[model samples]
Target: MSKILIISAVFAPEPVVSAKLSEDIANELALDYQVVVIAPKPTRPFGFDLQKDENNQTIYRLQNLDSYVFPESKLLGRLKESYSFGLACKKYISQNRKNIDLIYMNSWPIFSQYLIVKTAQKYKIKVVTHVQDVYPESLSNKIPRLSFILRFVFLPIDKFVLKNSFKIIAISNKMKTYLAKTRTLSESKIEVVQNWQNEASFTSYKQKENQDRRIFTYMYLGNIGPVAGVDLIIEAFAQASIPKSKLIIAGSGSKKEELKTFVVKSKIVNVEFLEVPDGKVPEIQGSADVMLLPIKKGAASSSIPSKLPAYMFSKKPIIGSLDIDSATAKVIVESNCGWVVEAENVAELANKMKLSFKSTKGSLLEKGENGFEYAMKNLSKKNNLSQVTNIIKNALL
Candidate 1:
């Protein structure tokens, strides 16, 4: 059996942002390959201690990277922490390289990729880099000086790794185009494996429950991060004067307090932001009549929110505030699964929101039903695993 080692900076049992996708792919790959995962321990937003070693043991292999530089970092603390994590990973991999045949690293801390690159080269193992967000495209433009430093040092290394890697998996087509522009690699070396949802997560199918509710509820699940366009969605919902309609925004983030401040300052009465209980994301989604996916303009090309599959699973019509050409927009429009609007366009979003609520009484339910059917037909975890396995097979050839 091929032994594959997966490295991620953040992971399971903590409800951390990237864990779901990492865990899902790792678990799926485990069906065919022996999988081992490396991840950091949990901490608070401002870096406080939390439950350690309590992560969900089912899906993740869970090796704790113990360094205070991580969960304790403020401002440039992540840079310091990630550098340490990279060093630790390199040391760990160097010591344990004999057991692994291939390496796959998720990019966020970016240093994880760096460690994989270093170790894979030493061990002469194939390495695949899975990008959830684009680097220079997102962060480079945000902070120019830092971006210059990154472009000077990291970007070239990233390009080298991408070119030399056995495979590069992009979460979106736009990201693939971006990488293709910079890297001299065969088209076959690059693949777009969009994010996926677990088939079992759709518990609605397993045991029937009454989904019929009187109130026309709209829900937004996932991070309250700025890039997610949570503020814009609230503004749009504020403008939407639809009576008796409640909007529930679930999940937490760095901007949670700031977003709460905005709601309080603006007196947006209809919108409620709740800290959703971990693993109960479906419970919140199922409670809604419709779902809203709002992404701000100029966020990042790797902007296909992972929540898309969850929204689709909810079987509620989604009104996505994403650019027309964006990955999420393509998914919504192509699947005929939901509606897409330009980011931060409150008027347009409000209009679509009103329309979804008004129209779902009749054929709108049919639209949601269509979305669920499409999700089952196309976006199942099995299909994702098949795609990943096919890519691995092709790369091996």
Candidate 2:
């Protein structure tokens, strides 16, 4: 079997979208190919761990890196982590060049990605890049202080790596188009494969009775990190102050404590914070009446959140606070499953919350059905995963 190397920033034990994707792809590919993975030990949401970690297998090479966890070192720390992981990948590839048939990387951009690709080329190894979020521009949302100057330097290195990669998998068409146009790359170079979630996982969602006695509940699940705009969600929910309605913010990230502080200080009575243990996704999702999808300004131009598929699969209406032209906003409109307000606009978000709260049960259910139908037709996991694995197999043949 041809050996494939999977280099990711995080892996299975890390309970995040990217880590799950990395795990799925690795296990799937392992059936027909010799698969090896190079990833940091579980360290994202601060508390996840893999206790029985073994490093002796030739099929697995896990690394211990200096990556910062949530509520810890912010920007400079991430840069250090990225550089640190990049060196790990580079060293491994340099030592195992003859054994690696191809590399599939879902990792931090600019530093980590560049170093791996640059070194891989020396030995004629092909790399397939999985694009999650567009960087440099997205950096403006993360670290505005140096984005302007850094873009000038980062762009060229970015262009070189992407342009040299054997294949690029962009999660949405809007992102694919944006990359092609802005980077002056060939249209055929990038393929669109959504970071698909397993529909079967949600099939277990039963028609359960609502646990909360509130008239309506809105939920924001997943990371509470910088780009999540979770702060915006908290503020909007507080401002809406809808009677008989409550907001549930679930999952972990860097911004949790600050958001908790904001909620308490603002005297937001109806909002709640949670630490969602694994295996409770369907239950947590099935409880909500509407899904709150909020992204900060300029951040949604290139990518869709991994949560969108889950929200849609749960048959819940979404109220997206995203850019008008963003891929995510377009999906919400086209599916007619939710409402879209201006990204980062507190007033607009509040108004939409009120509107959704007042919507009739029939109207909300109809919207939920619309989103489920859309996910079925467009985001099928089997089809998308086959596309990804085929891209890898054909690259070698």
Candidate 3:
């Protein structure tokens, strides 16, 4: 069998979207191709007891993410990490160049992708890039002061990665369009394939409905990083101050302690914080009356959050604090599962929270069911897996 090397920032057993997608893809591809993965040691939400092997694949677990992903710093850390991972994978590709038929890149942008694409060219290997985010632009949002410099220095590398890819898989049509317009990529080169969750896992698990009937809960789950805007959510939840309503912030990140400090200083008592252990998504999602999906003002203009599908599968109505034009906001509106408010607008988010609390149970349930139905039809893992696999397989052919 021909061999395929998968380069991903995260992989199996890591409970993030990319990890799950990469893991699923690896499993699917292993049926006919010898699969190998190069990924960081699993140190995402938390540290993992590393697994160096899989059933039908080889896993090259490099340095732990803690060594590279410096949450305390700014863009410099990301640049360094990307370069480090890029060079490491470059060395591996050079040694195994003869065996690598194709490289399915779901890794970082600019430096890492450029290095990978360059190495692929030298080895006469085909490359299919799975884009999770539009970089340089995303980086610009982070450091607006140096936006010009970031774009000037890194944008061309990003273009090279896209230009050289045999095919590009974008997670949403919005992303595909954005890449085409911004990166000047050809429409035919970019294919839309959604990031999917295994809905069957929800079927196997029973949702515990043991909450107090009088109280309304709004919950946020996932990373609390720089662009997560959890502080904004906390402040809005406090401003709403709906009697018998509470906001539960679940999951850990670099800013968790700072957020807790802010809450304590502000005397925000209606908000609660807890760490979400892995495999507890169903439990946490089931417990919430409304899911809170918040992204910073410009953080997610084209991409949908991985949690959105899982949130829908849990059958909970959503309230998204995001830009009206964003892909996530569009989904909330289109799916009829949620409401959208301008991101970073505290008063608007507060009003939305209050409205959600005052809404009738029937109205909320209807919306939740609407999202579930949409996810069933549009976000099926099997369908998306086959689409992505075919895109790669066809590219190789």
Candidate 3, which ten residues in sequence have the lowest lDDT sum?
58-67
- Number of the top candidate by lDDT? 3
* Candidate 2: regions farther than 4 A off: 46-73, 212-214
Give per-residue lDDT, candidate 2, residue 336: 98
The models' CA-based lDDT, in order, is 0.72, 0.83, 0.84
Selected candidate, larger TM-score, 1 vs 3: 3
Model 2 TM-score relative to the real fold: 0.93
Counting only residues 3 or more apart in sequence or on different chains, how many pairs clash (N, Cα, C under 3 Å) in candidate 2? 0
Residues 1-397, candidate 1: write the lDDT tens digits. 7777878777665565466667776777777668888866555333212344444455436687775444432336766777777887788789888987877777444565666687788788887777777764565644656867777767776777687677888877777877887766676667987767775767455432336555578788876765678888888788887887878888876677788898999889878877766656777776777788887776654556667877787777889887777777887887787788887788999998888867836566776777778777766676775686566545544
Better structure of 2 and 3 per lDDT: 3
**Rank order by TM-score, top first?**
3, 2, 1
How does candidate 1 score on lDDT? 0.72
Local accuracy of candidate 2 as per-residue lDDT tens digits, 350-378: 99999998899889999999998998878
Poorest stretch of ten by lDDT in candidate 2:
47-56
lDDT tens digits, residue span 206-245, model 3: 8877379778899998877888899898989988889988
Error of 3 at 63 (Å): 11
